[model samples]
Target: MRVALGDFLELNLRVRSADDARLQTIFGFWPAFLVAFALRLVGLFKFPFLDEEDRMMRVAVNGLFGYGPQSGQAPFWENLLFRTPLSNSQAITPLWWWTEYVARLVVKDETLSARLPALLTGLIGLALFYWLARQLFPFPIPALLAWLLAVHDVFLWVGTKAQYVESFIFALSVLIAWALLVAQGKWRPFVVAVLASTTAMGFFLLKGMTLTFNALAVGVAQTALLRGGGRRLNFETIVQRAIFAGLIVTPLAVWLLAAQAYITAHYQVRVAELGYFRGIADILYALTFGYGTGRTASLV
Candidate 1:
Protein backbone atom coordinates (compact mmCIF):
# COMPACT_ATOMS: atom_id res chain seq x y z
CA MET A 1 0.00 0.00 0.00
CA ARG A 2 1.77 3.15 -1.23
CA VAL A 3 -0.77 5.18 0.73
CA ALA A 4 0.13 3.35 3.92
CA LEU A 5 3.86 3.80 3.34
CA GLY A 6 3.34 7.46 2.55
CA ASP A 7 1.50 7.94 5.81
CA PHE A 8 4.34 6.27 7.69
CA LEU A 9 6.97 8.42 5.95
CA GLU A 10 4.92 11.54 6.50
CA LEU A 11 4.81 10.68 10.16
CA ASN A 12 8.58 11.12 10.31
CA LEU A 13 8.56 14.12 8.01
CA ARG A 14 5.97 15.90 10.14
CA VAL A 15 8.24 15.70 13.16
CA ARG A 16 10.76 18.49 13.72
CA SER A 17 14.43 17.88 12.80
CA ALA A 18 15.66 17.82 16.39
CA ASP A 19 13.17 15.10 17.14
CA ASP A 20 13.85 13.24 13.89
CA ALA A 21 17.59 13.55 14.45
CA ARG A 22 17.16 11.91 17.84
CA LEU A 23 15.95 8.85 15.96
CA GLN A 24 19.39 8.59 14.33
CA THR A 25 21.25 8.30 17.64
CA ILE A 26 22.88 5.14 19.02
CA PHE A 27 19.70 4.00 20.78
CA GLY A 28 17.68 4.91 17.74
CA PHE A 29 14.26 3.77 16.52
CA TRP A 30 15.40 1.09 14.08
CA PRO A 31 17.77 -0.43 16.64
CA ALA A 32 14.94 -0.64 19.15
CA PHE A 33 12.74 -2.37 16.57
CA LEU A 34 15.46 -4.85 15.60
CA VAL A 35 16.16 -5.73 19.23
CA ALA A 36 12.48 -6.12 20.01
CA PHE A 37 11.94 -8.31 16.97
CA ALA A 38 14.84 -10.55 17.97
CA LEU A 39 13.48 -10.96 21.47
CA ARG A 40 10.03 -11.87 20.21
CA LEU A 41 11.51 -14.53 17.96
CA VAL A 42 13.04 -16.33 20.95
CA GLY A 43 10.43 -19.11 21.13
CA LEU A 44 9.14 -18.88 17.61
CA PHE A 45 8.95 -22.64 17.28
CA LYS A 46 9.98 -23.78 20.76
CA PHE A 47 6.79 -23.82 22.80
CA PRO A 48 3.93 -26.07 21.84
CA PHE A 49 1.03 -24.54 20.02
CA LEU A 50 -1.81 -23.12 22.05
CA ASP A 51 -5.26 -24.66 21.70
CA GLU A 52 -6.04 -21.79 19.35
CA GLU A 53 -3.05 -22.72 17.25
CA ASP A 54 -4.18 -26.31 17.10
CA ARG A 55 -7.59 -25.24 15.92
CA MET A 56 -6.23 -23.02 13.17
CA MET A 57 -3.71 -25.60 12.12
CA ARG A 58 -6.46 -28.09 11.56
CA VAL A 59 -8.32 -25.77 9.22
CA ALA A 60 -5.13 -24.74 7.53
CA VAL A 61 -4.10 -28.33 6.83
CA ASN A 62 -7.52 -29.31 5.60
CA GLY A 63 -7.77 -26.31 3.33
CA LEU A 64 -4.31 -26.66 1.89
CA PHE A 65 -4.04 -30.45 1.69
CA GLY A 66 -7.59 -31.74 1.61
CA TYR A 67 -9.27 -32.83 -1.62
CA GLY A 68 -12.79 -33.81 -2.65
CA PRO A 69 -16.29 -32.91 -1.51
CA GLN A 70 -16.24 -35.98 0.68
CA SER A 71 -13.23 -34.56 2.46
CA GLY A 72 -15.77 -32.00 3.78
CA GLN A 73 -13.34 -29.10 3.86
CA ALA A 74 -13.69 -26.05 1.63
CA PRO A 75 -10.76 -24.75 -0.36
CA PHE A 76 -9.47 -21.43 1.04
CA TRP A 77 -9.84 -19.23 -2.02
CA GLU A 78 -13.20 -20.39 -3.30
CA ASN A 79 -15.45 -21.64 -0.53
CA LEU A 80 -13.58 -21.09 2.73
CA LEU A 81 -13.24 -17.93 4.74
CA PHE A 82 -14.68 -19.10 8.07
CA ARG A 83 -15.51 -22.82 7.92
CA THR A 84 -13.07 -25.36 9.27
CA PRO A 85 -12.77 -29.03 8.34
CA LEU A 86 -13.39 -30.18 11.88
CA SER A 87 -16.37 -28.03 12.81
CA ASN A 88 -18.33 -24.88 12.14
CA SER A 89 -17.01 -23.32 15.32
CA GLN A 90 -13.68 -23.21 13.53
CA ALA A 91 -14.88 -21.00 10.72
CA ILE A 92 -15.17 -17.75 12.64
CA THR A 93 -11.46 -17.02 12.59
CA PRO A 94 -10.70 -16.85 8.89
CA LEU A 95 -7.56 -14.73 8.44
CA TRP A 96 -5.13 -16.96 10.30
CA TRP A 97 -6.14 -20.12 8.49
CA TRP A 98 -5.55 -18.47 5.13
CA THR A 99 -2.20 -17.18 6.27
CA GLU A 100 -1.21 -20.53 7.73
CA TYR A 101 -2.23 -22.24 4.53
CA VAL A 102 0.05 -19.98 2.52
CA ALA A 103 2.90 -20.64 4.89
CA ARG A 104 2.25 -24.38 4.64
CA LEU A 105 3.02 -24.25 0.90
CA VAL A 106 6.83 -24.06 1.38
CA VAL A 107 7.04 -25.39 4.89
CA LYS A 108 6.31 -29.12 5.10
CA ASP A 109 6.13 -29.22 8.88
CA GLU A 110 2.44 -28.59 9.35
CA THR A 111 2.65 -27.07 12.78
CA LEU A 112 5.65 -24.84 12.12
CA SER A 113 4.28 -23.79 8.77
CA ALA A 114 0.99 -22.80 10.35
CA ARG A 115 2.83 -20.73 12.91
CA LEU A 116 4.88 -18.69 10.45
CA PRO A 117 2.20 -16.05 10.01
CA ALA A 118 2.10 -15.09 13.65
CA LEU A 119 5.84 -15.10 14.00
CA LEU A 120 6.32 -12.97 10.91
CA THR A 121 3.44 -10.62 11.64
CA GLY A 122 4.63 -10.29 15.20
CA LEU A 123 8.07 -9.23 13.97
CA ILE A 124 6.54 -6.66 11.64
CA GLY A 125 4.37 -5.46 14.50
CA LEU A 126 7.44 -5.01 16.67
CA ALA A 127 8.96 -2.74 14.06
CA LEU A 128 5.74 -0.79 13.59
CA PHE A 129 5.37 -0.54 17.34
CA TYR A 130 8.61 1.41 17.48
CA TRP A 131 7.59 3.71 14.65
CA LEU A 132 4.19 4.40 16.17
CA ALA A 133 5.65 4.87 19.61
CA ARG A 134 8.15 7.31 18.11
CA GLN A 135 5.30 9.18 16.45
CA LEU A 136 3.64 9.65 19.81
CA PHE A 137 6.50 9.73 22.30
CA PRO A 138 9.84 11.54 22.47
CA PHE A 139 13.25 10.16 21.37
CA PRO A 140 14.65 7.28 23.37
CA ILE A 141 11.39 6.74 25.18
CA PRO A 142 10.06 4.99 22.09
CA ALA A 143 13.22 2.86 21.94
CA LEU A 144 13.07 2.15 25.68
CA LEU A 145 9.39 1.31 25.60
CA ALA A 146 9.88 -0.96 22.61
CA TRP A 147 12.56 -2.85 24.52
CA LEU A 148 10.30 -3.18 27.54
CA LEU A 149 7.48 -4.49 25.39
CA ALA A 150 9.84 -6.97 23.75
CA VAL A 151 10.50 -8.52 27.13
CA HIS A 152 6.93 -8.06 28.23
CA ASP A 153 5.23 -11.33 28.95
CA VAL A 154 2.16 -9.66 27.55
CA PHE A 155 3.51 -9.74 24.00
CA LEU A 156 6.11 -12.48 24.35
CA TRP A 157 3.70 -15.23 25.31
CA VAL A 158 0.40 -14.77 23.53
CA GLY A 159 0.82 -11.79 21.23
CA THR A 160 3.49 -13.45 19.10
CA LYS A 161 1.70 -16.73 18.61
CA ALA A 162 0.51 -17.73 15.14
CA GLN A 163 -3.14 -18.28 15.91
CA TYR A 164 -3.73 -15.01 17.65
CA VAL A 165 -4.88 -11.95 15.68
CA GLU A 166 -4.12 -9.50 18.48
CA SER A 167 -0.55 -8.77 17.46
CA PHE A 168 -1.65 -7.79 13.99
CA ILE A 169 -4.66 -6.06 15.41
CA PHE A 170 -2.58 -4.14 17.92
CA ALA A 171 -0.06 -2.99 15.33
CA LEU A 172 -2.82 -2.05 12.87
CA SER A 173 -4.61 -0.20 15.63
CA VAL A 174 -1.53 1.92 16.18
CA LEU A 175 -1.29 2.62 12.47
CA ILE A 176 -4.92 3.67 12.36
CA ALA A 177 -4.41 5.93 15.37
CA TRP A 178 -1.29 7.48 13.92
CA ALA A 179 -2.99 8.11 10.62
CA LEU A 180 -5.90 9.72 12.38
CA LEU A 181 -3.58 12.02 14.26
CA VAL A 182 -1.87 12.98 11.03
CA ALA A 183 -5.14 13.53 9.21
CA GLN A 184 -6.54 15.60 12.05
CA GLY A 185 -3.88 18.18 11.37
CA LYS A 186 -4.83 21.23 9.34
CA TRP A 187 -2.66 20.03 6.46
CA ARG A 188 -4.88 16.95 5.97
CA PRO A 189 -2.51 14.95 3.79
CA PHE A 190 -4.57 12.75 1.49
CA VAL A 191 -2.25 9.79 1.99
CA VAL A 192 -2.61 9.95 5.75
CA ALA A 193 -6.39 10.08 5.49
CA VAL A 194 -6.44 7.10 3.17
CA LEU A 195 -4.11 5.20 5.44
CA ALA A 196 -6.29 5.88 8.47
CA SER A 197 -9.42 4.76 6.67
CA THR A 198 -7.70 1.76 5.07
CA THR A 199 -6.28 0.62 8.38
CA ALA A 200 -9.70 1.06 9.96
CA MET A 201 -11.16 -1.08 7.18
CA GLY A 202 -8.57 -3.81 7.69
CA PHE A 203 -9.00 -3.87 11.47
CA PHE A 204 -12.75 -4.18 11.07
CA LEU A 205 -12.44 -7.02 8.60
CA LEU A 206 -10.21 -8.86 11.05
CA LYS A 207 -12.76 -8.45 13.86
CA GLY A 208 -15.58 -6.02 13.50
CA MET A 209 -16.67 -5.90 17.11
CA THR A 210 -13.16 -5.53 18.42
CA LEU A 211 -12.35 -2.87 15.86
CA THR A 212 -15.56 -1.04 16.76
CA PHE A 213 -14.49 -0.49 20.34
CA ASN A 214 -10.93 0.41 19.43
CA ALA A 215 -11.85 2.74 16.59
CA LEU A 216 -14.39 4.63 18.68
CA ALA A 217 -11.94 5.10 21.51
CA VAL A 218 -9.04 6.16 19.32
CA GLY A 219 -11.20 8.24 17.02
CA VAL A 220 -12.61 10.20 19.93
CA ALA A 221 -9.23 10.75 21.49
CA GLN A 222 -7.67 11.96 18.25
CA THR A 223 -10.59 14.19 17.41
CA ALA A 224 -10.69 15.82 20.77
CA LEU A 225 -6.95 16.17 21.10
CA LEU A 226 -5.86 17.00 17.58
CA ARG A 227 -8.84 18.02 15.50
CA GLY A 228 -9.46 21.76 15.40
CA GLY A 229 -6.23 22.32 17.29
CA GLY A 230 -5.01 23.78 14.05
CA ARG A 231 -7.93 24.89 11.86
CA ARG A 232 -11.69 25.04 12.09
CA LEU A 233 -13.74 22.31 10.43
CA ASN A 234 -15.84 23.45 7.49
CA PHE A 235 -18.38 21.80 5.18
CA GLU A 236 -15.66 20.82 2.74
CA THR A 237 -13.65 19.29 5.57
CA ILE A 238 -16.66 17.34 6.76
CA VAL A 239 -17.34 16.14 3.23
CA GLN A 240 -13.77 15.10 2.73
CA ARG A 241 -13.70 13.15 5.98
CA ALA A 242 -16.98 11.45 5.11
CA ILE A 243 -15.72 10.50 1.66
CA PHE A 244 -12.54 9.08 3.08
CA ALA A 245 -14.48 7.09 5.66
CA GLY A 246 -16.82 5.83 2.98
CA LEU A 247 -13.90 4.67 0.88
CA ILE A 248 -12.43 2.84 3.85
CA VAL A 249 -15.65 1.13 4.97
CA THR A 250 -17.57 0.48 1.76
CA PRO A 251 -15.34 -2.22 0.26
CA LEU A 252 -15.09 -4.20 3.48
CA ALA A 253 -18.80 -3.91 4.01
CA VAL A 254 -19.42 -5.30 0.55
CA TRP A 255 -17.03 -8.17 1.11
CA LEU A 256 -18.72 -9.03 4.39
CA LEU A 257 -22.11 -9.00 2.73
CA ALA A 258 -20.95 -11.54 0.16
CA ALA A 259 -19.15 -13.50 2.82
CA GLN A 260 -22.19 -13.62 5.07
CA ALA A 261 -24.36 -14.85 2.27
CA TYR A 262 -21.85 -17.51 1.32
CA ILE A 263 -21.45 -18.53 4.94
CA THR A 264 -25.15 -18.75 5.53
CA ALA A 265 -25.78 -20.89 2.48
CA HIS A 266 -22.76 -23.12 2.95
CA TYR A 267 -22.32 -23.32 6.70
CA GLN A 268 -25.57 -22.39 8.43
CA VAL A 269 -24.37 -22.59 12.00
CA ARG A 270 -23.24 -19.07 12.82
CA VAL A 271 -20.45 -19.71 15.26
CA ALA A 272 -18.54 -16.54 16.14
CA GLU A 273 -15.17 -18.04 17.05
CA LEU A 274 -15.55 -20.31 20.06
CA GLY A 275 -12.15 -19.07 21.16
CA TYR A 276 -12.48 -15.57 19.78
CA PHE A 277 -13.55 -13.92 23.00
CA ARG A 278 -11.27 -16.13 25.05
CA GLY A 279 -8.32 -15.36 22.81
CA ILE A 280 -9.05 -11.68 23.25
CA ALA A 281 -9.23 -12.15 27.01
CA ASP A 282 -5.94 -13.99 27.00
CA ILE A 283 -4.29 -11.01 25.32
CA LEU A 284 -5.83 -8.60 27.83
CA TYR A 285 -4.73 -10.81 30.69
CA ALA A 286 -1.21 -10.93 29.32
CA LEU A 287 -1.21 -7.15 29.19
CA THR A 288 -2.40 -6.99 32.77
CA PHE A 289 -0.51 -9.84 34.46
CA GLY A 290 2.44 -10.25 32.09
CA TYR A 291 1.71 -13.96 31.96
CA GLY A 292 1.58 -16.10 28.80
CA THR A 293 3.37 -13.37 26.92
CA GLY A 294 6.44 -15.55 26.49
CA ARG A 295 7.35 -19.20 26.87
CA THR A 296 5.44 -20.88 29.67
CA ALA A 297 8.83 -22.02 30.90
CA SER A 298 10.26 -18.51 31.17
CA LEU A 299 8.81 -15.18 32.20
CA VAL A 300 12.12 -13.49 31.48
Candidate 2:
Protein backbone atom coordinates (compact mmCIF):
# COMPACT_ATOMS: atom_id res chain seq x y z
CA MET A 1 0.00 0.00 0.00
CA ARG A 2 2.82 2.38 0.92
CA VAL A 3 4.67 1.65 -2.31
CA ALA A 4 1.49 2.11 -4.36
CA LEU A 5 0.76 5.39 -2.59
CA GLY A 6 4.32 6.56 -3.22
CA ASP A 7 4.01 5.59 -6.88
CA PHE A 8 0.77 7.51 -7.23
CA LEU A 9 2.28 10.57 -5.57
CA GLU A 10 5.30 10.39 -7.86
CA LEU A 11 3.11 10.17 -10.96
CA ASN A 12 0.97 13.10 -9.83
CA LEU A 13 4.06 15.17 -9.00
CA ARG A 14 5.64 14.34 -12.37
CA VAL A 15 2.49 15.52 -14.11
CA ARG A 16 1.95 18.74 -12.17
CA SER A 17 5.34 19.90 -10.96
CA ALA A 18 6.80 20.96 -14.29
CA ASP A 19 9.63 23.55 -14.44
CA ASP A 20 7.42 26.00 -16.32
CA ALA A 21 4.73 25.75 -13.66
CA ARG A 22 7.25 26.42 -10.88
CA LEU A 23 8.71 29.42 -12.73
CA GLN A 24 5.34 30.94 -13.46
CA THR A 25 4.24 30.65 -9.84
CA ILE A 26 7.42 32.20 -8.53
CA PHE A 27 7.39 35.07 -11.03
CA GLY A 28 3.72 35.80 -10.42
CA PHE A 29 4.02 36.14 -6.63
CA TRP A 30 7.32 38.03 -6.38
CA PRO A 31 6.20 41.35 -7.87
CA ALA A 32 3.16 41.55 -5.59
CA PHE A 33 5.31 41.04 -2.49
CA LEU A 34 7.82 43.66 -3.67
CA VAL A 35 5.07 46.16 -4.35
CA ALA A 36 3.39 45.54 -0.98
CA PHE A 37 6.68 45.96 0.87
CA ALA A 38 7.47 49.18 -0.98
CA LEU A 39 4.03 50.59 -0.22
CA ARG A 40 4.26 49.72 3.47
CA LEU A 41 7.68 51.38 3.71
CA VAL A 42 6.38 54.49 1.93
CA GLY A 43 3.29 54.58 4.16
CA LEU A 44 5.50 54.65 7.26
CA PHE A 45 7.20 57.84 6.07
CA LYS A 46 4.37 59.90 4.53
CA PHE A 47 0.84 60.12 5.91
CA PRO A 48 -1.69 61.01 3.25
CA PHE A 49 -4.70 63.11 4.06
CA LEU A 50 -8.01 61.15 4.19
CA ASP A 51 -11.22 63.09 4.48
CA GLU A 52 -13.12 60.33 6.29
CA GLU A 53 -10.34 59.67 8.83
CA ASP A 54 -11.54 62.42 11.13
CA ARG A 55 -15.12 61.10 11.03
CA MET A 56 -13.90 57.58 11.87
CA MET A 57 -11.81 58.99 14.68
CA ARG A 58 -14.81 60.85 15.98
CA VAL A 59 -16.86 57.65 15.86
CA ALA A 60 -14.09 55.74 17.67
CA VAL A 61 -13.69 58.42 20.36
CA ASN A 62 -17.44 58.65 20.71
CA GLY A 63 -17.70 54.89 21.05
CA LEU A 64 -14.97 54.80 23.69
CA PHE A 65 -15.91 57.40 26.24
CA GLY A 66 -19.30 58.35 24.73
CA TYR A 67 -18.86 62.01 23.78
CA GLY A 68 -19.11 63.27 20.20
CA PRO A 69 -19.64 66.66 18.54
CA GLN A 70 -22.70 65.44 16.67
CA SER A 71 -24.42 63.97 19.68
CA GLY A 72 -27.88 65.45 20.14
CA GLN A 73 -30.09 64.92 23.16
CA ALA A 74 -28.32 61.67 24.13
CA PRO A 75 -24.71 61.24 25.24
CA PHE A 76 -22.36 60.24 22.42
CA TRP A 77 -21.71 56.83 23.97
CA GLU A 78 -25.43 56.17 24.31
CA ASN A 79 -25.87 57.16 20.69
CA LEU A 80 -23.28 54.61 19.69
CA LEU A 81 -25.19 51.88 21.49
CA PHE A 82 -28.48 52.85 19.88
CA ARG A 83 -26.97 53.48 16.47
CA THR A 84 -25.80 49.86 16.24
CA PRO A 85 -29.24 48.79 15.09
CA LEU A 86 -29.42 51.44 12.36
CA SER A 87 -27.35 50.93 9.17
CA ASN A 88 -25.27 54.10 9.02
CA SER A 89 -24.72 55.52 12.46
CA GLN A 90 -22.20 57.71 14.20
CA ALA A 91 -21.05 54.48 15.89
CA ILE A 92 -18.28 52.18 14.78
CA THR A 93 -18.86 48.43 14.80
CA PRO A 94 -18.50 47.30 18.41
CA LEU A 95 -15.44 45.10 17.74
CA TRP A 96 -13.59 47.68 15.63
CA TRP A 97 -14.55 50.43 18.02
CA TRP A 98 -13.14 48.47 20.95
CA THR A 99 -9.97 47.70 19.06
CA GLU A 100 -9.43 51.41 18.36
CA TYR A 101 -10.27 52.25 21.96
CA VAL A 102 -7.69 49.73 23.18
CA ALA A 103 -5.11 51.07 20.76
CA ARG A 104 -5.83 54.56 22.06
CA LEU A 105 -5.09 53.32 25.56
CA VAL A 106 -1.55 52.61 24.39
CA VAL A 107 -0.96 55.31 21.74
CA LYS A 108 -2.83 58.22 23.46
CA ASP A 109 -2.20 60.70 20.65
CA GLU A 110 -5.34 61.03 18.50
CA THR A 111 -3.47 61.19 15.16
CA LEU A 112 -1.39 58.10 15.88
CA SER A 113 -4.44 56.38 17.24
CA ALA A 114 -6.25 56.86 13.94
CA ARG A 115 -3.30 56.08 11.67
CA LEU A 116 -2.04 52.91 13.37
CA PRO A 117 -5.26 50.96 12.86
CA ALA A 118 -5.39 51.89 9.17
CA LEU A 119 -1.73 50.98 8.64
CA LEU A 120 -2.22 47.62 10.29
CA THR A 121 -5.40 47.07 8.30
CA GLY A 122 -3.46 47.92 5.13
CA LEU A 123 -0.81 45.32 6.02
CA ILE A 124 -3.53 42.75 6.56
CA GLY A 125 -4.95 43.70 3.18
CA LEU A 126 -1.56 43.12 1.54
CA ALA A 127 -1.15 39.70 3.12
CA LEU A 128 -4.70 38.72 2.22
CA PHE A 129 -4.12 39.75 -1.41
CA TYR A 130 -1.04 37.56 -1.58
CA TRP A 131 -2.84 34.57 -0.13
CA LEU A 132 -5.95 35.05 -2.26
CA ALA A 133 -3.96 35.60 -5.45
CA ARG A 134 -1.85 32.51 -4.84
CA GLN A 135 -4.98 30.47 -4.28
CA LEU A 136 -6.87 31.86 -7.29
CA PHE A 137 -4.02 31.58 -9.78
CA PRO A 138 -2.20 28.57 -8.35
CA PHE A 139 0.46 28.77 -11.07
CA PRO A 140 1.52 32.34 -9.96
CA ILE A 141 1.29 34.63 -13.02
CA PRO A 142 -2.42 35.29 -12.73
CA ALA A 143 -2.04 35.69 -8.98
CA LEU A 144 0.72 38.23 -9.50
CA LEU A 145 -1.32 40.06 -12.11
CA ALA A 146 -4.25 40.28 -9.72
CA TRP A 147 -2.00 41.37 -6.88
CA LEU A 148 -0.37 44.06 -8.99
CA LEU A 149 -3.80 45.32 -9.97
CA ALA A 150 -4.96 45.22 -6.36
CA VAL A 151 -1.99 47.27 -5.17
CA HIS A 152 -2.12 49.81 -7.96
CA ASP A 153 -1.27 53.41 -7.10
CA VAL A 154 -4.86 54.36 -6.40
CA PHE A 155 -5.28 51.51 -3.92
CA LEU A 156 -1.93 52.23 -2.26
CA TRP A 157 -2.74 55.90 -1.98
CA VAL A 158 -6.03 55.08 -0.33
CA GLY A 159 -4.48 52.43 1.94
CA THR A 160 -1.98 54.91 3.35
CA LYS A 161 -4.69 57.30 4.45
CA ALA A 162 -5.59 56.88 8.11
CA GLN A 163 -9.20 55.69 8.68
CA TYR A 164 -9.91 55.79 4.96
CA VAL A 165 -12.63 53.40 3.67
CA GLU A 166 -10.82 52.49 0.42
CA SER A 167 -8.26 50.28 2.15
CA PHE A 168 -11.00 48.23 3.77
CA ILE A 169 -12.99 48.10 0.53
CA PHE A 170 -9.96 46.94 -1.46
CA ALA A 171 -9.09 44.29 1.15
CA LEU A 172 -12.62 42.98 1.40
CA SER A 173 -13.00 42.99 -2.39
CA VAL A 174 -9.99 40.74 -2.84
CA LEU A 175 -11.06 38.47 -0.03
CA ILE A 176 -14.63 38.07 -1.25
CA ALA A 177 -13.52 37.53 -4.83
CA TRP A 178 -11.11 34.81 -3.75
CA ALA A 179 -13.70 33.16 -1.55
CA LEU A 180 -16.26 33.10 -4.33
CA LEU A 181 -13.77 31.71 -6.82
CA VAL A 182 -12.46 28.94 -4.59
CA ALA A 183 -15.35 27.97 -2.35
CA GLN A 184 -16.21 24.30 -2.83
CA GLY A 185 -19.93 24.80 -2.30
CA LYS A 186 -19.12 25.19 1.37
CA TRP A 187 -20.88 27.27 3.98
CA ARG A 188 -17.67 28.64 5.53
CA PRO A 189 -16.47 30.48 2.44
CA PHE A 190 -19.94 31.87 1.84
CA VAL A 191 -20.07 33.10 5.41
CA VAL A 192 -16.67 34.71 5.00
CA ALA A 193 -17.70 36.38 1.76
CA VAL A 194 -20.79 37.66 3.48
CA LEU A 195 -18.74 39.18 6.30
CA ALA A 196 -16.30 40.73 3.85
CA SER A 197 -19.26 42.12 1.90
CA THR A 198 -20.64 43.56 5.11
CA THR A 199 -17.34 45.28 5.78
CA ALA A 200 -17.30 46.56 2.23
CA MET A 201 -20.76 47.95 2.80
CA GLY A 202 -19.43 49.77 5.84
CA PHE A 203 -16.92 51.45 3.58
CA PHE A 204 -19.77 52.39 1.27
CA LEU A 205 -21.69 53.90 4.15
CA LEU A 206 -18.64 55.82 5.21
CA LYS A 207 -17.44 57.15 1.85
CA GLY A 208 -20.71 56.88 -0.13
CA MET A 209 -19.65 57.62 -3.74
CA THR A 210 -16.13 56.25 -3.69
CA LEU A 211 -17.28 52.89 -2.32
CA THR A 212 -20.51 52.79 -4.30
CA PHE A 213 -18.55 51.93 -7.42
CA ASN A 214 -16.98 49.02 -5.60
CA ALA A 215 -20.36 47.73 -4.46
CA LEU A 216 -21.63 47.87 -8.02
CA ALA A 217 -18.51 46.04 -9.19
CA VAL A 218 -19.14 43.27 -6.69
CA GLY A 219 -22.76 42.99 -7.80
CA VAL A 220 -21.65 42.67 -11.41
CA ALA A 221 -19.14 40.01 -10.46
CA GLN A 222 -21.80 38.09 -8.61
CA THR A 223 -24.09 38.25 -11.60
CA ALA A 224 -21.34 37.02 -13.89
CA LEU A 225 -20.49 34.14 -11.59
CA LEU A 226 -24.13 33.12 -11.34
CA ARG A 227 -24.52 33.30 -15.08
CA GLY A 228 -21.30 31.51 -15.93
CA GLY A 229 -21.12 27.88 -17.21
CA GLY A 230 -24.60 28.20 -18.69
CA ARG A 231 -25.93 27.02 -15.37
CA ARG A 232 -29.67 26.66 -15.42
CA LEU A 233 -31.32 29.56 -13.65
CA ASN A 234 -33.64 27.60 -11.42
CA PHE A 235 -36.00 29.81 -9.50
CA GLU A 236 -35.70 27.75 -6.35
CA THR A 237 -31.91 27.94 -6.36
CA ILE A 238 -31.97 31.64 -7.10
CA VAL A 239 -34.49 32.34 -4.35
CA GLN A 240 -32.63 30.22 -1.85
CA ARG A 241 -29.33 31.91 -2.54
CA ALA A 242 -30.97 35.30 -2.49
CA ILE A 243 -32.54 34.57 0.86
CA PHE A 244 -29.24 33.44 2.28
CA ALA A 245 -27.41 36.44 0.88
CA GLY A 246 -30.11 38.73 2.14
CA LEU A 247 -29.83 37.20 5.58
CA ILE A 248 -26.14 37.91 5.55
CA VAL A 249 -26.70 41.43 4.27
CA THR A 250 -29.64 42.37 6.47
CA PRO A 251 -27.77 43.97 9.35
CA LEU A 252 -25.55 46.13 7.21
CA ALA A 253 -28.27 47.14 4.78
CA VAL A 254 -30.65 48.00 7.58
CA TRP A 255 -27.99 50.15 9.14
CA LEU A 256 -27.23 51.93 5.88
CA LEU A 257 -30.86 52.63 5.01
CA ALA A 258 -31.60 53.77 8.55
CA ALA A 259 -28.65 56.09 8.56
CA GLN A 260 -29.56 57.56 5.22
CA ALA A 261 -33.14 58.10 6.29
CA TYR A 262 -32.05 59.65 9.58
CA ILE A 263 -29.55 61.95 7.91
CA THR A 264 -32.11 62.94 5.29
CA ALA A 265 -34.80 63.53 7.86
CA HIS A 266 -32.58 65.58 10.15
CA TYR A 267 -30.17 67.39 7.88
CA GLN A 268 -32.51 67.77 4.91
CA VAL A 269 -29.45 67.27 2.76
CA ARG A 270 -28.30 64.26 0.73
CA VAL A 271 -25.83 62.23 2.76
CA ALA A 272 -23.61 61.90 -0.26
CA GLU A 273 -22.55 65.12 -1.95
CA LEU A 274 -21.66 63.96 -5.43
CA GLY A 275 -19.58 65.84 -7.98
CA TYR A 276 -17.27 64.79 -10.77
CA PHE A 277 -13.94 65.80 -9.34
CA ARG A 278 -11.78 64.50 -12.19
CA GLY A 279 -14.61 64.50 -14.80
CA ILE A 280 -16.06 61.59 -16.84
CA ALA A 281 -13.18 61.74 -19.31
CA ASP A 282 -10.82 61.27 -16.40
CA ILE A 283 -12.45 57.90 -15.79
CA LEU A 284 -10.89 56.69 -19.02
CA TYR A 285 -7.56 57.92 -17.72
CA ALA A 286 -8.24 56.30 -14.35
CA LEU A 287 -9.11 53.03 -16.08
CA THR A 288 -5.89 53.29 -18.04
CA PHE A 289 -3.65 54.16 -15.05
CA GLY A 290 -4.37 57.88 -15.23
CA TYR A 291 -5.29 58.51 -11.58
CA GLY A 292 -1.89 59.84 -10.59
CA THR A 293 -1.80 61.99 -13.74
CA GLY A 294 -1.45 65.76 -13.30
CA ARG A 295 -4.07 66.73 -15.90
CA THR A 296 -6.86 68.84 -14.41
CA ALA A 297 -10.21 69.70 -15.99
CA SER A 298 -13.63 70.96 -14.90
CA LEU A 299 -17.10 69.87 -15.98
CA VAL A 300 -18.23 71.70 -19.12
Best by TM-score: 1
Q: Kindly list the per-residue Cα lDDT of model 2 for residues 27-53, writing each as its tens digit.
A: 655566666757765774566545565
lDDT of 1 at 44: 70
Candidate 2 lDDT score at position 1: 100
Question: Cα-based RMSD of the predictions, in order?
Answer: 10.1, 8.3
lDDT of 1 by residue, 1-300 (tens): 999999988887767656654654445656666665666566775777776666545544554566533244444454444344213222243444456666777787866675566667666677777777766776657777777776777677655566555666666666666655544444344445455445533432324344555666765676666555884446686688768757766765665566556545653432324222233234233333444335232112
Per-candidate TM equals: 0.66, 0.58
Residue 64 CA displacement from its true place in model 2, Å: 6.6
lDDT of each: 0.55, 0.55
Residue pair clashes in candidate 1: 82-91, 153-293, 156-293, 156-294, 157-292, 157-293, 157-294
lDDT measured at residue 220 in model 2 versus the true structure, 0 to 100: 58
Give the least accurate 10-residue stretch of model 2, judged by summed lDDT: 269-278
